[model samples]
Target chain A: IAGITQAPTSQILAAGRRMTLRCTQDMRHNAMYWYRQDLGLGLRLIHYSNTAGTTGKGEVPDGYSVSRANTDDFPLTLASAVPSQTSVYFCASSDSLRGDTEAFFGQGTRLTVV
Target chain B: SQQGEEDPQALSIQEGENATMNCSYKTSINNLQWYRQNSGRGLVHLILIRSNEREKHSGRLRVTLDTSKKSSSLLITASRAADTASYFCATDNFRGGGADGLTFGKGTHLIIQP
Candidate 1:
């Protein structure tokens, strides 16, 4: 069973371009999250969804948007990519929003904006 | 800003040696989780310790939490070349008594020299 899968393993885009990072999970998890990782920094949460229709802003939400159309998918979109937005993005999911539950992660997408 | 801060950014040791990494946070959390990631890959859940719990063990990994000092540590015993990866500590900040997400540290790069 593929726990989670992310599209576009790596991509390079021009500044001001639009891009979307897709994440899908077959686990039917109730909660999903998006995070970005930069050198010398840990993963930073960009957005999260507690359930299919409810979403919340995370620690780092600027320049990013996410939607949970269904239980299996959560997509992160960058309306206009910028050089500063280039980073490794990761998608994670959990059975519930409970803090103690283990979170499963998908292989990250490396995005570069020039 | 990053809530958890890991000490000794990098560590290198012999295959059989023990490796320890510490993480400190600013506020109280519901739980602390440890994750491991190989270069350019998604993170894998290692272990989790709750606020009320002190220590937890999984195989060769031992994790300790001290709420008084607002810190946590992950100890890997009998490390192997396969164990060489970046270790991260994530805290679920439920400080306000509501739903919260994880905040990751800079992570500790553990290199197992064979």
Candidate 2:
């Protein structure tokens, strides 16, 4: 139970609206990531933070933003919601950026844009 | 862009049989990892293999990594209905100076008929 926790298991938003998905980890991990899972696209990384105060973009970063203000929280925000952005979002954390580290994931947030 | 690609997007097998999934990547990786996700749930870490490691085993799961060929495989022996899920292969690549994140491939959906 001492892993990642994501808020709002599911949400429905209107087009052009803004939404923020919350993620927190109790493991004190140094690396955190945000990914969106779609039917045929699999999991695509949106943003990542190697540590607190540092953030980097992943494969698909457009229209999404993330902030790693602290070690325990990494929040992903969508500036303007769109139908194409509707997908399940997951949060993951690892001990470090080392190659051998294993990542832990959250239950995921299912967001639907209408 | 997606760095890793999984083969045989979907597979069906009978219970107690074995299941195998393959993944290939486009770049040099520091490590490769396998994860499983049950329907409407979070992803669970199955195993991790470093660039220098050839194979690793954990319980009923086996993972093989061939860095030279930039491919990896996961084999599940004596599979059960519980083994039915989406399996994904992720790569931790050496991105040269910026913070690194895992690049995931489209997962393989395994169905174990009971």
Candidate 3:
């Protein structure tokens, strides 16, 4: 089974354009997260949802928004993409919010905003 | 600034040599986890060490947590060429009845040369 699937493995978006990164997991996880991976900056959390219908801003959520309509889907949207937004986006999920529980990640989405 | 920082941004060693990566964080955490990422791919969880625990092992991986020093280390024994990848340390600050709290380090790129 595909534990997690992310759409549009790679994307090139122009500055000021709107873009959405879609993530879905079949594990029926209770917690999901969106993080951006940048060189020398590590993975910065953009948004997270502990469960369906609840969302919280992460460390770098200024230009991103996320919605969790169901248990399987959590999408990250950039209202206006910018050059600085170019980075690899990863979607991860965990069975629960337990401290010792591990997270499963999907193949990242490589987005380049020019 | 990111909460976690990994030392030796890049590491290279012979295939039979052991590789060690260190991670330091700024705040109290529920647990510290190690993850590996291949080039142009997503991250895979390697191991997790709780704040209350001192050490853990999985296969060839040996992870040590020193909460008093706010640091952790991962050791890979008998490294192989296939062990070449970027390794990251993530800190979870989750507390009961709250949103998930996590942060990641810039990661150490380890290269196991044949």
TM-score of each candidate structure, all chains considered together: 0.96, 0.96, 0.97
Worst 10 residues of 3 chain B by lDDT: B93-102
Write candidate 3's Cα lDDT for A24-94 as tens digits.
Answer: 99999999999998988989999999999999989899999999999999999999999999999999999
Q: Give lDDT tens digits, candidate 3, residues B1-114.
A: 588899989999999999999999999998999999999999999998989999999999999999999999999999999999999999988877654746999999999999
Tell me the lDDT of model 3 at B70: 99
Candidates arranged by TM-score, highest first:
3, 1, 2
Better structure of 1 and 2 per DockQ: 2
The digit string of per-residue lDDT tens for model 2 on A19-94 reads 9999999999889999999999989999999899999988899999999999999999999999999999999998
i-RMSD of all predictions: 1.6, 1.5, 1.5
Hey, what RMSD does candidate 3 come out at? Answer: 1.1
DockQ of each: 0.71, 0.74, 0.74
TM-score of chain A of 2: 0.96
Q: Which residue pairs overlap in candidate 1's backbone?
A: none
Superposition TM-score, candidate 2 onto the true structure? 0.96
Best by TM-score: 3
Name model 1 segments beyond 4 Å from true.
A97-99, B95-99
